[model samples]
Target: MYETFGAVVQGPRVEFHLFLPDNARDPSQYFRGGSPRIKQIHVRGDFQDAVGSQNWSLDQTFKMQRLEHPHGWLYKLAIEQDLNDGYYQYKYFVEFENGTQRWVSDPIAKYGGNDQNENSAFVIGGRHTVVHPIARRRPPRDLVIYETHLDDFTAAFRHDKTPVDAFRERLDYLQELGVNAIEFMPWTAWPGSGFSWGYDPVAFFSVENRYVDDPAKPADKLVKLMELINDLHERGMQVIMDGVFNHVRAGNDPNLGFPYRWLYQVPSDSPFIGAFAGGGFFEEFDYQNNCVAEFIRDVCLYWLDRFQLDGIRFDYTLGFFRQGDAGVGIAKLIADLHQSLNQTGRSNVALFIEHLTDNRFEAIRDTNDIGAAGCWFDPFMFKHFEYCRNGNIDSGILRILNANLDFAPGKEPVTYLENHDHSSIMQEAGGRGRWFKTQPAAIALMTAPGAVMLHHGQEFGQEEWLPGSGDGRVVPRPLRWEESPLGGDAIGTRLFGLYQRLIAIRQRHPALRSPNFFPFPFNHPEGYGAFPEQDVVIYHRWGQAEDGGFERFIIVVNYSDFDQRIDIPFATDGHWEDLLNGGVVFVDNQKLRRQKINSNWGRIYYRKA
Candidate 1:
C-alpha cells in the first residue's frame, strides 16, 4: 500500500514523516567524508492562541529516531496540542555534528511561507478540498489548448498586481473563444522578487504566494487556487499544469541566503551530479535515486489528487532522457507515473512531454499502456513558419506531414504554430497587423488531424514579443488586455473572430480530428500529377459515416505571395461547401481545372455527395 509522506494532521494531532535514504547519510557517499551528520531535527512554527495572536518561536523539538524502510531510513515525529483552526507556517531546524545549525523547509510540504525566505506551511483545518466535476472531462485528442502565464495574463489589469481572482475574471473570454483547455506556464512557488515564469520551481507542491490576495490568512493561497480550478471546471475548461521536473532552482544568492543551497545538496553517489556539461542553471534531480524518484512521483500525484488537475505537461523531457541510455531511465519513470494515475480510475487524464525533436518521439510514446498521451510537435510549427515566410514548400515538409499517417497517427502529436517558446506569427511577419497572411498557417494547425494549441495573445493577433529574457526568463509586462478583442481592439477582434470560426469548424467536422490524413501529391512527380509547383498542397481527411458512406474534407492551401490557378482531381464531386467562407462550388467534370485561389490562403471544402 502507498502512503503520503508529508505532515498528516487529524484533529489536534499531527504526524510528520521524512525519508532520508541510508546512503544519504553515509560518510563514504560524500567527496571528503565530511557531510553533515544528523544531530537534532526540530519543527518550529507559530501556534495560534485563543486571542488570535501567533507565537512565532520554537517551543517543541524532536529527538532523531531512525527506522529502516525499503527505500531508506524514516524519521517520524508525532505531536498533540491545542491549536487554532487556521493555517500556520513551519520549518525544520537541523543541527549538524560539526556545530553548524540550519533551518530548512520540508521537501514535501504542500504549502509555504509568503515572505522571501519561502518557509513551508500547512493548513490545520482549512476549508479547501478537491472536488472533481463530471462535466469537464474530455479526451486528449479533442483538447483545444490555450497556453498563458498567470501573471502575464492578469497582472496588467490591476495596479500591476495579478491576484488569483483577476485570472478568474477572464474565464468568460476564454470560453467565448471556444478553447477547452488552458495550459498555465508553471505556477509553482519559485525564488524571485518581481514577476517570473515560475519554471525555476523551488516548491513543487505549494502555490505561488504572489497570486494570493491575503498572505496572513492561513490556506488562503490554496483556497484561492482551488477556487480558480473549480471556476475553470465550472466554465467547461480543463486545467493542465506546466510542471518542471527536470531541474530545480538551487543557488546561493545573497538575497536568497544560504538556506536555499542547503535544501538541494544531494549525495555524491547520486546519478544527477555530472550528467550535464558544466553546471546547469538549476540543480537536476537524479532520476535513478529512489528518494528523488519518489519525491517527483509524489509531486505529480499531489497536484492531480489535491487540485483535481486534468493533466500535466512535463517541461524539457528531452533533458531528462539525454542523461543516460537515451531516455530509457526517464521512460520507466514516466511509465510508473502513468500507471499510478491509471490506478486512480481517471484514465482520461492527459499526459504530455516536451520533446521537440522528431526522433525523441519514440522515447515518450505510449508503450504497454504506460506512457505519455502525446508530445509537443515542433516540426510542424517550424516547417509551417518557414513555408509561410518564404512561400516555398520543400519536400521536407511533405515528408514530415506524411511520416506516420497510419501508426498511432494523429492522437500522439499535439500541433501548434505559436506558443511561449517561439515568437508569435504576427511578430514573425514583420510586426505589422497583417494577420490575414497567417490564416493559412492557422488552417494547417487546426485541421492537421492532431490536437491544436494556441498561446494567450495569439488569438488576438498580439504583435508584441513575449516579454522575457533571452534565456526564457519571464519578465513582468503591462497588461495588453486592451489590445485583445475583448478590450475593443479592432484588429484583435477580427483575428479573434477568425480563430473562433476555425475552431468551430474543427469541432463541427469529425474528419478534421480523425487519425487518417492523406496528402495528395500536388507537386510530386508521378503522384497525383496535379500542380507541379511547390507552393500549393492539398490533403484529404475522412471518417466513417453513420449512413455507411464516408465523411470527407479536402483542404487546399496556397503558400505563395502571388495568386495562382490550380487543377484539382475530384472524385465525382457534386457540390462542395467552403467552410471558411460558406461558399458553394459545383463540379461536374472529373478534373476541376483552373480554380482561382488567393495568395497565402487556405480553404476547407466539405464535399456533399
Candidate 2:
C-alpha cells in the first residue's frame, strides 16, 4: 500500500506523516537551497480523552520521530500512539536548524477545518466510504456535464440544509434536465471563509466546513458530503470534483492563507512552495521537488479510494506542467494516478485538464503524454461565443466541432459554451431580448461532438454578468428557477424546453456519440466554411449500426436573421425523422433541396432506413 500522509488511523493508533524534503543536503546559493533541518518536532493537541482537563494545551505535546530510508530523509511522523475512538484537534510545532519555530495546522489534514483559522484535526476512525455504489462508468464523449457551485446552485432552491443536502433536495430538477454527470467547481474547501468560485483553494484534503449547516462539527462535514455523492450515484449520475493542484493560497495572514506555505522558520525552505509552469496566480507549487508531486498525488489517490468519484477536472495545466518535464510535475502525478486506477480495476473515469497555453489547441494535444483523457475545449468555447454574438462562424466550424480529429485514440475534448469562468448564455446572447440567438449555440453544444457541459441555470437562460477578472468575478449569483419555463419568463420558457428537447435528442441518437463526422461533403457548393455569407452549416455524424448498415444523422444550422434554404446532404435515401420540430420526410435521392432552417435555429434529421 502507498504510504499515506496526515493523521491516518491505523486500528487503535494514528500515524501522522509529514513531508519536508531536503533535510540533509549541502547548502546551495539560494536561501536554504538545502532546507534547514528540524532539531525537534512535536504534535500538540487535545486528541487524548481527558474528562477532567481541557485538551490542546501548548505545554502538552507529542514528540515526533524521523523515518530514514535514504541519504536525505524526508518524513517526520508522530510516534504511534493508541487513543480513544473519537475526534480530536491538533497542530504541529517544529523547531528548525536556524533555531526558529512556529505552530501550524497539518498541511495534509484529511478532516476538521474552519474558514479564517486552521486547526488540523481528525477522528480516530474517520475514513468514510460512500454507501451507494459508484454508478456505471460512461465514456467521456457520452457525458452531459452540468458544472455548478455547491452554494450558488442550491442557495436559491433551498438553504434549509447544507449545500450538499440542498443539491440532493433539488436532485430531481437536475435529473429532469438529462445531465448524466455533475462537475462541481473546486469543493476542496473554499477560499478563506467567504464565498468563492472556489479557485483559491486553501485546504486540499478537507471539505469546506461553511458548506455544512453546522460548521462546528468538522467530523460530520465529510460524511454528509459523501452522502450527497452516494445519492447522486444512486440516481445514475456521475460526480466530478474540480481539483486545484497547481498552487495554493498564500500569505501568512488569516482567512485566505495556507499553512504549508509558511510552516517553517525560513518559509522558502519549505519544500512544497515555489514557482514553475503554473499561471502567475496566488502561490504556485515548486514541482522541482519530488515531495510536492508525491503529496498531491496522494491527495488524488485518497479521494478516489475514499469518495468514489467518477471523474476529476484539473483546474489549469499551464500552471502545473512544464516543458521537457518527462517524468515529473503533473505528468508524474497523472501517471501515478492512472497506474493506481488500473490496479484497482477502475475504467472510464474521466481525467481532463484546462491546458490553454501557447497554441492551446495544440497544447491540449500534448495532454495524452501526461495520461489525461483530454482537455477543456477553450478554443471551442471562445469560437462559439463569437458565433452566438455575431451570427456566423467565419473560421472553420468543423475543426472546432470535430475536436481531437487527429488526437490519439483515447484522448478527446470536453466542450462547453459557458462554464464558471464565463457569462451565461443569456448574457452571451446579448441579454434575454435576443434569447433566440442562443438556440443555435445550444443546438451545436449538444449536437456537434465530445463531452458536453451546461453551466448551472444555463438551461433556463440565467443572465448575470461579472467582470472577466479580479475579485468581482468570484461573487455568487444564485439561479432563478422560478423564472424558468415552468415559472414565468418568456425567454427562459422557450430555452428550457429547447434544452430539454435537445438533450433528449442527443440521448436518443447514437450517431451523436460516434466519432465519425464530416462537414457535409456538398456536391454543388464545393465549400466547407460555415461563414456569414453562407448563413447555413450542414454536417453528418454516423455510427455502425447493428445490421451492418450505418445509423446516420445530418445536422442543419442557421445563423442568419432570415430563414435559409440549402441542399442538405443526407447519408441515406429513406424515412428521415426531423428530431427538432417533429416531422417525417422522404428522401429518395439522398439529398433534401431547399430545406428551410429557421433564423438562429437548427434541425437534426435521423435516418430510419
Candidate 3:
C-alpha cells in the first residue's frame, strides 16, 4: 500500500513521516562512505506548550522513532494527545553521526508558518480538505492559453495591495479575452518569505507563504488557489500550472537550500541531488534513484489531484532528460501519471514539455516516446518574429507556420508569439507603434493548426524591454490594462480588438483547428506561391465536419508594408465571409479572386456554416 510522506492528518492524530531511503544502487560512489546517519529526530513546535513549555521550546524535545520501510527507513511521529487545538507550528531537530546536527523543515510541508526558521504548520481542528470538481473539461487541441504570473497579474490595476481581494471580480474581464485556458506561473514554496518567481521551490507540497494574506494562517493560501481555480473552471476556462520538477534550489545558505537537501550531512551524498543532465541550471534531480522519481511523482500527483488542475506545463525538461533513457526522467513520470489518470477515469489532463533544444524535431520525437500533449513550438515564434520585424518572409516561413508539416498526422503543437520566457510580442515588433504589423501575425497564430497561447496582456500590447541580465525575468512586468481596448492607448487598444476577433474566429471555426495546412494556394503548385519579394503568402486549412462534408478556410497573409493583391482560390461559387473583418466578398468563378489585402494584415474567408 502507498503512504503519503510529510505530515498526514489521519483521523484524530497527525502522523509525520520523514523519508530517507537506503540506496545500494546509488550512482554516486560518495554514498558508500560518510553518508548521513540519522541518530535521533526531535519534533520541536508550539504543541510543546500543552506539555507545560513555551512555543518552540527545545527544553525537552519530542523524539521520533525510526522504522524500516519497503523502500528504506522512515522517521515517524504521531501527535494525538499533544494537540489542544487551533494550530501548531513545528520543525525537526535532527542529530546525525559524530554529533553533527541541523534543523530542517518538512520537505513536503503543505503549509508554512510565520518564522524565518523554516517552520511547517498544521491546523489541529480544521475540516477535511475539499476537492472541487472541474466545471468544464476541454481537450488539448481546442485550447487558447493565456500565461500570467499571479503576483504580476494581480499586482496591477489595484492599489490596496490585497492581491487576491479583487481577483475574482477581475476574472470576468479575463474571460472576455476569449482564452479558454489560463497557464499560471509557479506559486510553489520558495526559500524566503519575500518575492520570488517560485521557480526554485524548496517545499514541493507547500504554497509560497509570502503570496498569502497571512503567513500564520497559510491554509488560506491553498483555499484561495482552489477558489481561483474553481472560479476559472466556472468561467469555462481550464487552468494549467507552470510545474517546475526538473531541479530545486539547494545550498548551505539559509535562504537558498531545500529542507531535504539540508537534512543530509553532506548534501552531495543525498540521492535526490545530483547531475542528471548537463543543464547545470540548479540542483538537478537524479532520477537514477527510484525514491527520487517516486517523490517527484508524488508531488505532481498531490497538486493535480488536490487542486483539480486541468493540465501541467513542465518547465525545462532538458535539465533531466537523459539520452534515450525511457525508464526514468520525463518518460516514466508521464507514463506513471497517465496510468493513475486512467485508473481514476480522469480525462483530458494535458501535459506539455518545454524541451527547448536546438533540434526542434527532438520535441516531437520525445513527445511521441514519452507521451506528452505537445512541446512549446518556438522555432515558429523565431521565424515569425523575423517576418514581423524585418519583412524577411519566405517559403520556409510558411512551412514553419504550417505546424502540420512538423507535428504530423494528429499531433498538436503549442504555438505562441509571446510567452513568459520571451519579451512581449509588441516589444519584439520594435515598439507598440508597429502594432499594425502584428495583425497578420495574429491571424497566422489563430489560424495555425495547433494550440495557441498568449502571454498575459499580450492581447492589449504589454511591452517590456528585457535586459540581457539574468534579473530580466525577475523584473516587474505588469499588465497595463489602461492600454487595452478598455483603456486609452489607441495603438495598444487596436491589437486587443484584433485578438478578440481572431480568437472568436478560431473558436467558432473547426477548420482552423484541423491538421491540414497547405502551403500552396489551394494546393496548386503552379498557382500563386508564397512571394518572398512581396512578403505575402497564401494557405488553406480544412477538416472533415459533421454530415460527411468538408469545412474549409483560406488565409492570405501580407507581411510587407505595401498592400498586395493576391489570387484567392475559392472551392465553391458563393458569398465568402471575411471572418477577421466581417466583410462579405462574392465569388462567381470557382477559380480565383484578385483581392487587395491591407498591409501588415491577413484575410480569412470561409462560408457561414
Question: Considering summed lDDT, which 10 consecutive residues are worst modelled in model 1?
Answer: 27-36
How many residue pairs clash in each candidate at the backbone level? Answer: 1, 4, 0
Model 3, global lDDT: 0.76
Which residue pairs in candidate 1 have backbone atoms (N, alpha carbon, C) closer than 3 angstroms, thus clashing? 156-479
Off by over 4 Å in 3: 1-3, 10-13, 24-35, 82-87, 126-129, 158-166, 215-218, 408-410, 520-523, 526-529, 546-549
Model 2 compared with the native: what TM-score? 0.91
Over 78-158, each residue of candidate 1 has an lDDT whose tens digit, in order, gives 755655677767677776666766777766666767677667777777675675654848877778999988877876774
For each candidate in turn, the TM-score is: 0.87, 0.91, 0.93
Report every candidate's CA lDDT: 0.67, 0.74, 0.76
Residue lDDT tens for model 2, 1-609? 223567877776776777555534422212223454577777776764443234555443466777754424445554345676666777778777778777767777766454345667777655465555465888787788999898888887664577877778878878888898999988776455668777777778887766763544445777888888898898889988899988888766533467666655666666667877746578888777766776788778777878898889998877877666768777887888889999989998888888877676776646776768778887777877787777766646777777657557777788888888887767876887888888888888888768888888888888878787887887879888787865788877788789889998887776787677776322235333365576677777788654666678888888778888777777778889888999999887788787778898888888744
RMSD score of candidate 2 (Å): 3.3
Best by TM-score: 3
